[model samples]
Target: MTQRICGQVVRVEGPAFRVRGTDGTEWHGVVRGRLKKGKRTATAPVCIGDEVEVTPLSEGQAVIERVLPRRTCLVRRTPLGGRRTHGKAPPVQVLAANVDVVVIVVPAPAVRSTVIDRFLQVASSGGVQPVLCVNKMDLVPEPAARQHVAEVVTPYIRSGIPVVLTSAATRQGVDELAALLRGNLVAFIGPSGAGKTSLLNALCPGLDLRTREVDARGRGRHTTTTSAIYDIGGALVVDTPGLREVAFALDEKDAGDPLLLFEDIAGLAARSRFQDCSHVHEPGCAVKAAVACGELDEARYREYLRLRRALERSPSD
Candidate 1:
């Protein structure tokens, strides 16, 4: 007789899910009814990294009867701008679910805070931990580049968010990065060409994932089209492709939901003044204060404010 068990979804395709149970086997399971009824969302519900309950029907078949409440999730608006989203952007796209840490990889100093900050906002809403990992440290070892990274990423670091400078080429911070992700499920997210795939290859040699060069025109050719789960020994990382969507969330209704992610920002933002404060211009904004007092990166602060304003003007927000 087959056994029933709870599993964490490592991958999702259509309504089928690739889940890993505590028994250490990957199973193909379909969602149960009650779980779907609860969400009632426009976008298809199941996402990579979801924790669910599965009952075996046969050797390779199982039914997903329920989705155990997710401790964290990363969500975004759909690509097409629409009014259907109510006050903010329309529909939430869950890149991955139930992740413990969100590892944001970006280029040193040149890393755009607007993108990172927006990511922070999404993660904060999901109740996940965020870490800034600066890749290509080899290119920025000298004065200008190195100083730029320091100035830009300081804010996140000051917020108790771990910031690690790394070089996938020289293997500079690979060990440290691996150690940090050891025994935890970390979700790697960033724009194209940030060296996330390269870093993954470094951590688990011979994995050989495809990558591209950044164009002279300054735009990165998007790679890693879909989200994938990579397991390196004891550490498992969920690698998400570049975010093609630009929708904002409504009213921060999920603000208090533990299922939502982004604890780092929420923890700090809660101390800020104004219950509805967007963390942009409100007096006594702790987020801004961190930037002004050299506790946060100015570039990050500016970008965070920009996203804040965008969210403010966004539909349903």
Candidate 2:
């Protein structure tokens, strides 16, 4: 009888995978040809955090026979030639599987609301909880400047997303972030120089993940070239390569109302007089009314409209 065991994919590199078996052994495995040839929607059939059944062939070697169903997955639309696809809908690329929380790390004093909203949509659409992690808080030493950064993320906090202010240099909020991630599979995703690796090091001492400083232009240099999962104090954490842009993985059916992710906008929409109010230019539009009365954050409303417009535009358009 052949020895078959269950394992979770910890890292993927081209055609090779590192799977950690239930018996506490790490096996270098590759997917079976039949499994690779099967119909799939994602750009890759295997991703980090995927559970698979493996047949051990020899020491430290195995063949991945099947992939178990994912409880949750984080995905984004594949870019065309390094840009958003215009004509045909882009295929989805699965970033990680079985993710419980996605930590969107951003540097202080450089918070981009639009980018944060895009990441929120991706997490919400993928059935994963989103947490905003504002890293490098120590850079803003002055109280006024630090307050400004806090104000920038207040909209997200109001929308029920947990926001953690962390400074790897000062070890601030690292414990809070770790508590939030305890006992869950979390993925750290953000643009380069956001200190994802540094935070991981703080959480699990002596891990010593390589990190680089921001470039002269203030952009992060990519240090993590591939996605890999680490076992940290009973929690499984995945650190992924920095992303320059994030586009929603949506087909016609999956591209329904984007407002579902924007709780603040949705709440206002519920009060609109018209049951099908477009909110762009409609009579008794609660969303616009709130914006006019200064009850709603203008920036948040603008981002919501931008996302809605993007979704409304057809692929061919």
Compute the lDDT for candidate 2.
Answer: 0.86
RMSD to true structure for each model, in Å: 4.6, 2.5
Off by over 4 Å in 2: 1-3, 82-88, 290-299, 313-317
Summarize candidate 2's per-residue lDDT along 1-317 as a digit string, tens digits.
Answer: 79679999999877899999877899999999988788876778889999999999999999999999999989987764544445645568889999999999988868777678778878988889999999999888889988888777987887899999998889999999989998999999987888899999988999999988889999999989878998886788998988877777754555758786788898889999999897889899999999999999887787778878877763521
Residue range with the least summed lDDT across 10 consecutive positions in model 2: 80-89
**Candidate with maximal TM-score:** 2
Candidate 1 — worst ten consecutive residues by lDDT sum? 255-264
TM-score of model number 1: 0.78
Measured with C-alpha atoms, the lDDT of residue 39 in candidate 1 is: 50
